[model samples]
Target chain A: MAISGGAKGILIFAALALLALALAGFITGAIGAAFVDKFSGDENVVHGWTGDVLPLDQPAVHLAPQYVFGDHAGDSLDYDNKEAKKYDDSSKIFNDNSFVITNTILSSLVTSGVLIFLFVLGTARMSVVPGRLQGLLESLVEGLLGFIESVMGAGKGRGVFPLIATIFLFVAFNAWLALIPIYQSFGVIEDGHLKATFLRPAGTDLNMPLALALISFFFVEILGIRAHGIGYFGEFFRFGNLLRGRILTGLIDVFVGLLEGISHLVRVVSFTFRLFGNMTAGEILLLVSSFLVAFLFSVPFYGLELLVGLIQAVIFAGLTVVFAAIAVAPHEAEEH
Target chain B: MADLGFHWPSLLVFLVNFGILLAVLYYFGYKRILAMLDQRSASIRDSLSEADRVRQESTQAREELEAQLGEARRAGQQVLEEARQAAERYREEEQARARAEAEDFLRRARTQIEQERNQAIEQVREHFADLAITAAERVIDRSLDRDAHRDLIERALSESAEAQRN
Candidate 1:
């Protein structure tokens, strides 16, 4: 019997979601394996910022399908000293770990390379009347620039377009790249363990997301400073103003200022996790769906992932714009 | 949880990569396009403004032309009216001149006719007297003296004049 469109759509969605779940589970495994050492060593190999290490003889939570992680289990047993079992429980965060290359660095370089290639291709022969590729690039850039201007009035918005535009495009492309079937699936099997996913989503890693977030954060703060001299901090630290002014209003000002400062700091974390969580979740959903069903059945979920990827990028870029606008005009914000 | 791992090498690489991307996109792509777009917009605005100015000037020129046309028409009508009045005055002056000349000519002709008529009357009367005297001379045939006859003739003349007067 011929399947209805609805059934096909459902199958596709199910395939994508299952693929995301499976890939997400694999990311967990891969991270788990990163912590596990192949041979015994007296000094604990500092894997990342987290100093905590688990003896990998046995894993606490073996993620969804057990087979993909089975290779690591065998490797750990072969070397008895370093038990190869540790599963990540903490979500993505960025902290200073003395520079050691990770999969994220490789993925990021690849993503940037692709972006650079596209930029060169798009801007190769710039013309007033754009061709197809140029037109598409312009539309995306102009469309995004218009959105930023809308959020932050046209006059003030122009200065911050580079940061917001770059972040949006980079994050969006990274997210979309993750959706490709071979992105997380294709890897070299070394001693029964999958090694080196050739092209991973940069946003999926904590480093890239955090790095992007920091860029946005600093850009917003610096813009604020540049716009409103050193006095810009007066918006945050109102204790002196409180002492000099009416008690009630001053107290309110102080409290509001502190809250604003806290919110400003919180944005870094917010920006980081927002991109990280969104891309990671989409990656997981896609990975799980692909693992669960055929590629043909993952079409609907692929569409959904595309939409999610776009939304995440927009949201990330949008927040940065809003924050920047607010930072520039703090007095206006407080009045409201 | 696997995502929380921060590798500095990766982060540094990411920062540099993105930084390069921003510079490229900003300089080569976004900035260039924006400049072009701005130029296009400025050109459009200039064209629109130029068109507006030309339209305003044309409108003013048309109004001026209409005013001049109306003034010229009024001047033409005035000239025509002046010509008609001048023609009427000239005709009247010529008629008055002709009438005066005709009256003088008529008066002179009437005087001449009166003079001729008076002359003719005197001639006829003198001739009649001559004829009567002659006839009387033939009838009398020297029977009376010259002085006596002359007296008689005078008497006859007086009598005749009396008869004629009566």
Candidate 2:
């Protein structure tokens, strides 16, 4: 059945949300288990390992450092610290060090590297009569640029088009990476239990999302300042009445500035969380659905996951563009 | 278990992850993609403008060619008309010359005929006068009386005069 654009958008959003939740759950579970283990007398509480590693006979309990990775043989790769002690668990891999580098970070790095390489190679070989790869890349870039130009106005849109397009690709690729079987496997257990492994959503990971938000935030302010100079800061301090009769208005301006400042702070948190929550939730949903019904039932959900990844990426990029446009644009002179 | 509360480590992990993601994307993905897009768009604009210029030039050339063709056609027509007029003038002049020559020939023939007629009349008169004198001399040689000769002479004179008058 042909899906409408809105339906497709919703489906994608839902998938991303599910993924975000799943990742968040895994992280929270690990962290919560670690903290609880610190207080509780349970021996497993300190190691913080959960999921399939916990025997079915024993109810899983929260522990300190809820996940562990590497083995005593020192053969395993430890993300947090290469020097961390290793122990031989069922799969010769012990401890969950997935959160140390953060699965989201690793995935983003991989996705970005691949995408940039493709983009550069494609561009280098572009021709009027394009080869297959060149043609595909050109069309994709052109189409995206056209869309941005339409929304942002031709003159300004061209400036931010690349930034927005890149964000879309990065987020989309990372989301797809999360759906891969290897990432979902976490660890293989000899006893027939699967340990939940990586818990990073490239966008949903608070560090990545917050940092992106902050960059956008900083640039927005900077652009505003550049455009308006001293006047841009005046929106915050509002000390225009130091000389004379405008004291009352200055005080009011200060209040307005304060409010604006608060909103800017909120922007950082909100932008970060919005992406993080959506992506984490989507991951969780997909995981639960698959766990309940196995691989066959999860097939349709994978399509949903693909759509969700795309939408989340678009939404993130779109928001960035909007914020950038607003920040850079000179504030209208206050209409008295 | 105590009611679940806010987890600081999770928050820290989230912050750390967000930081790395932003760094990677900003450097590798965003910057590069943006550069590529800008280059692509500029090229497209250049192509469109070039097309517009070529179209304008072609139109101008077509118009110029049409103008030249029109001028050539007008010149040819003018030349053809001048030639026709010259031919007509030449024909009229030839016809006039022929008519004048015919008139001159007719006038000369008429003058020649008049002169020839006058000469023939003079010759005939001389011959008649000579024949009359010979006849008178023969009559005188036959002899007769003075009064009879005088009467005969008067009758001859009167008859000669009458013959001359007829």
Please give the CA lDDT of all the candidate structures.
Answer: 0.69, 0.60
* Tens-place lDDT digits, model 1, residues B69-111: 9999999999999999999999999999999889989988888
lDDT measured at residue A241 in model 2 versus the true structure, 0 to 100:
71
| Predictions in order: chain A TM-score | 0.69, 0.65
Every model's TM-score: 0.65, 0.62
Candidate 2 Cα outliers beyond 4 Å, as residue runs: A1-99, A143-153, A158-162, A180-183, A186-191, A198-200, A239-253, A295-300, A333-336, B1-93, B123-166
The residue ranges of model 1 lying beyond 4 angstroms of the native Cα positions read A1-107, A117-136, A180-196, A241-258, B1-3, B67-75, B78-86, B97-166
Give the proportion of true interface contacts each model preserves, from 0 to 1. Answer: 0.48, 0.08
Highest lDDT model number: 1
- In angstroms, the error of model 1 at A26 is 22
